[model samples]
Target chain A: MRWFNFVLLLFVTLVLQLGVGRLFGVGPQRVMPDLLLLLAVVLAFRGPADQALIACWILGLVKDLSSQAPLGSYAFAFGLLAWAIVRLREMFYGEHPITLIVLTFLCSFLAEIFVLFICSLKKVMEVESYTSFSLVIMFSAMLTAGLAPYGQWLILKLHRQLGLPRRRIYGR
Target chain B: MAGRRSERLSHKQIFTYLMMGAVVCMLLPVRVTNHLDHVLSVLVAPFSKGSQDMSLMVTDKIHQDDSGEVPSDTPEEPVDATIQDTNRLVNIEQELKYYKDLTDRLSGLRQNQSLDRARLIVAYITGSDSSNQREVKFLDRGTRNQVESGQIVIGWPKQIYKDNILNDEETDAIYEQALSGAVVGRISDAGSWTSSLQLISDPGMAMKVAIEPAPQRREDWRVKGILKGKGLGQISVHLIPATVPVKTGDVVLARSDDEGLPMDMIIGYISSCRRTEKNPVEWQILVQPAVDLQNLREVVVIKR
Candidate 1:
């Protein structure tokens, strides 16, 4: 039951990140911020690596299907993000809100640059448009970083409700 | 024993994930088919409607504010009898002119003795996805209406008949008015419930056009051309040589092959013209279409 709820939360977060976040234009240049990337990072740092991989795969597929870009682009970028986050899991703890925000900014920047690189290589978009492209990515990253602390608070609350062990710093 | 079980479970999980990814990749291209496109369009229609409603609300509010400031100050006086009488005489003259024009049009229709006759079906456009998928869902004009493919549809402009003449009776009238035109592309693939009307502005559309020199340049009227659409709300008339007497403000119309016509069906006037050096015998002419294709809701399909 707890596992199901976690998966559902991840799914809803991904959808909101793409749909509502896009509609509100809260991200970079009014583009949608990568909520799925943030979720994957959080999960990799705190939850099982296998679950993080699965979440990344599902979220990437959904984003690709909904967006105008060619398929497999988001999937490749997100899969790499999950792997990288998992590799860096030993360096940071999930309890630190500031660390989570900084990690989100860096991951989002890398993911966006990677997407732009792939798009340019495929001749889908011109390299000159990268100025506007970078603006949207930077703004989106800032917005996502701003929301990271709130997301951590919600994660902690959900963890408690699921009867998961609280961090030793926070009493159960 | 426990370690072996855990390893087997991990292998099974990897297989499941791989299978899922493979299935998603296969289905991605398949989802872009016509059926899925139509389904998604229907889903997105409501969002478009909401946006339109918001714009309308803003416009209506502005109109209300403008009306409040400019109240009519003139005291209502009964119209003068002499003025009314003069207006009545002018109205009769206009009616006679209208009836004469209508008679000529009907006579021309009767004289078309071509064996390759085409049929027409009057249909209303219910929905359209830009210039690409324009489906005209008629109000069940019935099978007897002979609404077939390749039929041309033309919208009749509103008729304004003189009130005093003919006791204000509604008579078929023809005046200088812009009418929307469309050709039937295909019938509904599923059922006879609806038919698709290919708009003139459609990318694949091509039609016969004829151009002549303006009346002012009748003495030097050595220029003639053909008009062709370049899609996305633009049209160009080609083949008029640079040395030929073609200029801006010259009238262009869909020339009828039928003889003894007093006036040509005016489509639009040439807005801009440029002489191409590569083709000295042709001038590139841009035309603003007379009929607003975007706002057209209904059109008449004339039998060819």
Candidate 2:
């Protein structure tokens, strides 16, 4: 995909995350899925190397910009997360909804932990308890993962319609 | 084959190095990073604000529809009548208070200090700080709205009614109850057009809270205590002597602070009460917030 198209996609997803996602209020903070990170995960598994990196890097930067957290926090976390997911792609089947769900869930969980660690190192902030926060992280992960299949499917279908062949995602 | 393998290995190394570079960049001077963040925020604000408005409109519509569809309950009418009677009594008490205030003002005996609701700015919460599990949210209003850090944000909750039947006499009471919605949180950070609020559910956050006296009580006996959030939907009130006539079902209100939150602002209702495990002498009270911290849409920020 052209770089401009990818950037446009990122912008649209960020808007969705900020606006439409807030309407899905399951708790005090709307328990909406993290669309930017979700898109990053989608690209990491299905897109070419350059596209995946650009998506992760841009999304992470946006996350940092929009949040009160320190800069580069999400960039590093998402970058590492994408790297890991790309490396692990060979171990599991890539096309199944269950695989995508599990991958998204695990990536989200790991990403939260990594960002928490970085924030702590910088003395940015501390939560009351990790045990309780873990439950929230788990719920958010599931929420993100629950929508993964559809997101990835749509992107993959769009790429196919554009005459981009489905590259062997695993071990590529 | 070896050449391709080496190329792939180099690609992985490049990825690792790039990740490391990004992490290292985070260690730059805080001031520099903050400036960059500010620049980015300027670019992101308009988009965030636009989306927040859309979300708020949708949520308001949903609440409107829900309000119209009368909920069903067992033996609903009689229960509603009972509630209505209770509300009527409370309304009478409020009317008495209003007259007393009027008389006091006429005689130069007293003056109310709490800021009027109209003076407060209504701000939309745009998003949550998802980096950590800390209960923080970003608001679309910031310094531009004269919103400052430590200003209290309040959620005005709708009163729970048993049935759809509207009572003519108690209609004003419903409006009164709605206005009495509890304090949701305080502004922890404020930008030019955006801010962040820390919820009362944050573990270490505390407030001076009290249980308002029963309507039937002739004596003004409010039990005051310090309430600290214990995370996970629980707040523990501290320094409450076991002897205090506090109990479950009593409505909790902010104990003081006429600026951020007035003494009369309802916080939540007491869900359970027990003696502290460590102190044994003081009471540990759990409050279920008057507002569902989950479904907040519009909130009033008392300008500090």
Candidate 3:
């Protein structure tokens, strides 16, 4: 596992997700992509399962701290998502760009669901306006899916520069 | 065969460890995290400053692109004397008009205590939180600047008056107390060098607002009501006493209660209002914030 490079990538993603993403949103809706989750999903396929789960946990912890959402919610959500994505890839995997796109959409959706479930259970925020909320979630998911491949490529490049061994969903 | 099982067991173990870590994190005292947040804000202050400057530059470029106009910061371009004269005239006109309006808004505050300018701290918005949380934004000012929680945040909208309403006199009378900037939110979490501001658009945020029709009108015509945030740039002023002459397009301004904010700062413009079938005694009014919050980049916090 390219643990050092992976952590570095996650750190950069965390900083961007914190506030820099504000630069990209447009229109009245102000949609911001979930870059941390995007990276976690990409790492799930490209890194060793164990290291990726650890990365997800750290990323989630950072997110929980940065946001007003209840602590442990994102940590649990991200860890569970990483674990589940790894299991899914091991069971049924593809190597094409479509695989990356679909995985991002699915993983993002899963993260949102897991976050909502945990938050609802904890009762920190009331679940309201499903129509608008889901639309925003779907917008973010689609936006993330659209950009996931390039991020994967960029992270792969960083790994290569760091002399880390590359792993894929399936053996060549 | 046992090797795979061992790996699976290790995976489970890691999961358990992560959960326990989260639990430990949650178990930590709130004050500890607040202190940690202060430290983190200080550590990131320099980076946040740089990013904020870059964001302003980027936003300027975007505005230039959308309007197809030459950016004002293009130093290489020849500066026309006529253009400079025109800009000066525009500035003078705006200042004159704003002061004229301020005269009316301050009339409301004249009956009350005057606001202290010494208490104002100009702060740049270092970053903004995404949609995952409430509509809160991070400001560059923090405890290091003696900016603590419960401070009032205000933003100056470029527009002098709310558009689409022809009643400029009545609107000016309602909004004049705030000078130029409208109340944005409170400094909810003040860190060491950075603080998060809960924007007025955040859900469940409630405040008292006064609705007035004309300058120095009778108390019988004035309405005091509660404005609550519904999120996504929507706010509603609720339960106005039915006797008050509340209308769809009336301007809503802060009505000082316990918050001690100046009563004349324009909260928003009421876009629509209706009496609920369930409660005809109350009027529900939808308000559009004076400034388009999506476009707000910088603000000032009032310590008092």
Candidate 4:
């Protein structure tokens, strides 16, 4: 049942990343929502850190292969995010919607920065001006944060339907 | 405890899984990967096509509404006849001039030792995708039309209608001259219905280029550069030194030294240029291609 939820989440994450995410223009800076990061955050809040880590690795690999970016960049960023979210779980409660939104925003922002950093390091992309980078990050964070409540709600519904407990849902 | 034993099994299982995965990665076939990429591109194409169709439909509707204002039913016979007669006279004069020019050009071709015999095939660009890298695919006049690989394809020249009126004769002349450009690259691969034009923009594409001496009053008039494509709608002309007075507006044309034939075919103007201190022998020159690459729906493939 846990495995099924993970697979379903992966499918939904990819669909949203490619479909609805693309529908929303990336803006002049060409920054779009990091749906995979959002999924990782939501999973980290409700499931075990280990499962979130695995999901991140798998999804990141898929993203790397699908996109024009170098491999393993997304996986590293996502794994770190999953670990951080799990460690912070004791300090924050997941029941609050605003908390979820903020967490999603922070994680997504970090993921984007990490990707940009990786690309630069790989010499695949030149670094944009600091001002442009900041604007893209701010806008992308706000957009992803705004959409987090719906993402959380979907995850919660799926968790319930699958008869999976909020705690101990993902094995450590 | 039972937990410890289960944990040990899990570790062993993971190890086995990782080993299997590594082996699979090493053994994966290139053809399988290419097929997967093709399938993914096909899946994504519909989304882009739908957006394109929507935009086109809106534009078409606006055009139809605008055209509705014109009185289409009005019978302007006398005006039409006058226009027709004028066009006929122009056509006769142009034909006589064309033959005379052709004769001169033919003689010049022989004297200049250039290849003059050629055939043309019209083609349409159906779709483009960058899976392995940026690639453009085209659907050309089929095998029945004798279209083959290594033939140069060029955009159909804009039809210059006589006074915004397109008579059949003028239209034919425009179509005939559609494939007059220099051969940059050729059909690398061919099929029964479609042939792949390995464009001059391909990374593997290589072609010889000749530079014309700069106009008088320019001290650095050494006019020779090789135009190489950097892929993704970017091209660079090499062998031009910083000392050469090449400016942004300077035209980079494809020139062949064969006598009797037109020497230079205009490629595009230089958009930006930079001199590399590390490479004093050459300057990196960027050229904005004259071809409207994104909108290339049809082209004429010429064999000479």
Question: Please, what is the TM-score per model?
Answer: 0.43, 0.74, 0.78, 0.49
Share of reference contacts found in each model: 0.02, 0.37, 0.26, 0.00
**Per-residue lDDT for B1-304 in model 4, tens only?**
6556543445335434533453353244422332232333334434433443344345436644345653444354355443334333322333454456567887456533222233445555433321112234434344556766555565522222212322224445534344232233456545455455555665445455544332233443437778776554466788886777677756566654432123234455578878777887777788755454443445666555
Model 4: residue A77 alpha-carbon error in angstroms: 2.7
Worst 10 residues of 1 chain B by lDDT: B159-168
Q: Which regions of candidate 2 fall more than 4 Å away from where they truly are?
A: A25-30, A68-70, A118-126, A160-165, A169-172, B1-112, B130-132, B158-179, B214-219, B230-233, B262-264, B276-279
Candidate 2: give the clashing pairs. A27-B294, A28-B293, A28-B294
Chain B TM-score of every predicted model: 0.49, 0.65, 0.68, 0.56
Q: Across residues B1-304, which tens digit of lDDT does each residue of candidate 3 receive?
A: 6555533457557768888877776656545554455455555555655765677567656655456875656552233332223223323333454456567777565443334332556676666664453577777778878888877776755332212212213433223323555677778788777898777777636777777552233233567777777665678787687767776656677654334453346666678888878888988778877656655566666655
Best by lDDT: 2
Kindly report the root-mean-square deviation of model 4 from the true structure over all alpha carbons.
Answer: 10.5
lDDT of 3 by residue, A1-172 (tens): 5567666666567667655776667446577788888877787777666777777877777667666655666777788788777777765554577888988898787777666555556554544575666666787888889999898888778777534357564421
Give the lDDT ranking, best first: 2, 3, 4, 1
The segments of candidate 3 whose C-alpha lies over 4 angstroms from its true place after superposition are A2-4, A117-123, A126-128, A161-164, A169-172, B1-15, B24-35, B65-113, B158-178, B214-220, B258-263, B276-280
lDDT (10s digit) by residue, model 4, range A1-172: 3677677667655544543343343542234566766777777777655555565556655554444344455565666677677677767866778998888888877776766665555544334244555556677777778879888787777886544465534234
**How well docked is model 2, in DockQ terms?**
0.36
Question: Which candidate wins on DockQ?
Answer: 3
Q: In terms of TM-score, how similar is model 1 to the real structure?
A: 0.43
